[model samples]
Target: MNKYATCPISTNRINERVARLNGLFTFLLIMLFIITRLWYIPAFLAFDFLMRSINLSKFSPLAYLSKGIVKLLQLKKKFINAGPKIFAARIGLLVSSAIFIFSLIGFNITAIVLASVLALFSFLETAFGFCVACEMYPYLNRFLNRLQ
Candidate 1:
């Protein structure tokens, strides 16, 4: 069997530098939520993720910020397949939504733990260009296929 049989693929491309910058912004926002215990932060992140997931990245605040930063820095664009990133955004939307709900329900510890994991994933993406969500996609896809 092919190892990456169920991995996402797309002809669409996106700037890797901007995507990494967005990851940095996401990490910072998650940390801000952890520090302030502000439910709105996660809510905002969830909304931003939703925008990105839906291919409406121009509407995402993080994407706007990251694009501006990339332009200001004169970073050369490195194009990458958009499919994995889109998958990652969907996962981000789910995690951020869960975090927001957990915070609203007074599950502080659970929210914190989940946020920490998200922060770690974002940090990895920002610092190392490693996408945990992309790595997990094949396995998740295989599992879901088996369930169907």
Candidate 2:
């Protein structure tokens, strides 16, 4: 469990405070989607997650917003391995994409449930620094390795 705290899959490091802020933004966006039932909210999140997942952080609006907020708050940097956060972004992309597709096809219930779960995950990340996706990564990595 402790090993996951410093994920070694990527050598890059990122500011943990900024990552938490990004999670907060994600949580708020999902809550907004839940309240407004606007399909584009999830769609935008999916696109943003896609950008981050692909290492194009410069293109992610959430990243930019998070960075700005951190700067405004004068938060001290706390660096951590980027691997877990990158993996979490990929999971976010998949979940948001599913929410978008489900909402588009009239499966409102499914979309809402998924959105709720995603919101909870994001909340945990923001409030508790607990990343469910990061915990799942080692098992997933081992599974993928075995398939090779």
Candidate 3:
């Protein structure tokens, strides 16, 4: 039998590098949404949402950029439970999808509002290490379980 077969080097967690990179991606998308010249940006973000929601971040271009940033900054990988982040990503996906649909329908004001909220979320993650969606997951879970 192999020694330490049960010892796993990692688990269901992502490091700060990945989290920060994701925040940067969201921040940029928020800017694009606000700029108004880049109409296709939201469509691209919709695709990114699909990629992330499906757990394909490894294939995402922004992931590559974030990896580069992590290397450049020599940031340490401090892994934390991935469940919360995944929940947060789903929330982000919903918001981005809504923004995409609203923008496509020319409901610019609604799109802007949603995008701004997303921007706030991303900014909090990037600047303050706060994740609203992640924070809400436990409460939401309990609430749902109560419903059932």
Candidate 4:
């Protein structure tokens, strides 16, 4: 048994503002991909993956931008469980990577569909505080466990 599984880190470690900002950033980038089908979005996606891997997403460029938006708008912090949001970020990373690969390989329709899905998820998180990836995490874990 993994000791960490029994004694996981506290979930309330990140601010809600960060998650919202992340969603907002994701939404914008995905929309850009939908419109341009270019490299910028994919490059940012790669960067996001790298930062998350290093546990430095809090210091990411969009994070700073989001913080600025919060300050500029005088938004209040609404802290919540960090675990789900982190999971959602991982999902975002995966989708973005796929979008990048598909777009690069000339699979425009597939990339567009994936980007649309990602944008929808981001919009939900940004506007409604709902995270599809977060909601799916538990079920996915259980399913994987059963399959093993």
Q: What is residue 37's positional error in candidate 1, in angstroms?
A: 0.4
- Model 2 vs. true fold: TM: 0.92
Find the 10 residues in a row with the least total lDDT in model 3. 1-10
Q: lDDT per residue, candidate 3, 51-139, as tens digits? A: 76567878666666787888898888888766666677778878888888888888888989988998999999988888888767666
- Write model 1 residue lDDT over 1-148, tens digit each, in one string: 6756777888889999999999999999999999999999999999999999999999999999999999999999999999999999999999999999999999999999999999999999999999999999988898898999
Output the worst ten-in-a-row residue range by lDDT, candidate 2. Answer: 1-10
- Model 3 C-alpha lDDT versus the unseen true structure: 0.75
Best by lDDT: 1
* C-alpha lDDT of residue 64 in model 3: 64
* Candidates ranked, most accurate by TM-score first: 1, 2, 4, 3
lDDT of 1: 0.96
Q: What is the TM-score of each candidate against the true structure?
A: 0.97, 0.92, 0.84, 0.86
Provide the lDDT at 114 for model 1. 96
**Candidate 3 TM-score, true structure as reference:** 0.84
lDDT of all predictions: 0.96, 0.93, 0.75, 0.77
Instruction: Please identify model 2 stretches exceeding 4 Å from their true place.
Output: 1-8, 146-148
> lDDT tens digits, residues 1-148, model 2?
4545445478888999989999999999999999988999999999999999988998999999999999999999999988889999999999999999999999999999999999999999999999999988877877777999
Cα deviation at 79, candidate 2, in Å, is 0.5
